[model samples]
Target: MFSLYVFHLTPIQTKNPYPTKELDFYSILWSVLFVKLLIYFLAFITY
Candidate 1:
């Protein structure tokens, strides 16, 4: 399950592939964290 989520995020990470643009990298990191947190929240509720 976690592996699948990481797999899905790999493409988005690869798209940027560099930290030359700080804002873009931070935004992407935030988005990924948000998504992972959301997923965990949903799973916790369901469980």
Candidate 2:
């Protein structure tokens, strides 16, 4: 079961063949959202 999961994830883990500007914008947006979530979680922990 674990090997099967790894096999499925392998292709998704590969780098993009041709990343465009749109991809970069989306990635930046995703990173911002991730940071926001992390901060929220940390605040919740401290409060």
Which candidate comes out best when scored by TM-score? 2
Residues 1-47 of candidate 2: C-alpha lDDT, one tens digit per residue: 33554464445446554356755665566567666877887899999
Q: Which ranges in model 2 have alpha carbons more than 4 Å from their true place? A: 1-19
Clashes of 1: 0
How far residue 13's Cα lies from its native spot in candidate 2, in Å, is: 8.0
Q: Assess candidate 1 and give its lDDT.
A: 0.72
* lDDT tens digits by residue: candidate 1, 17-43: 656586477657767887888889899
Error of model 1, residue 26, in angstroms? 0.1
Give per-model TM-scores. 0.57, 0.60
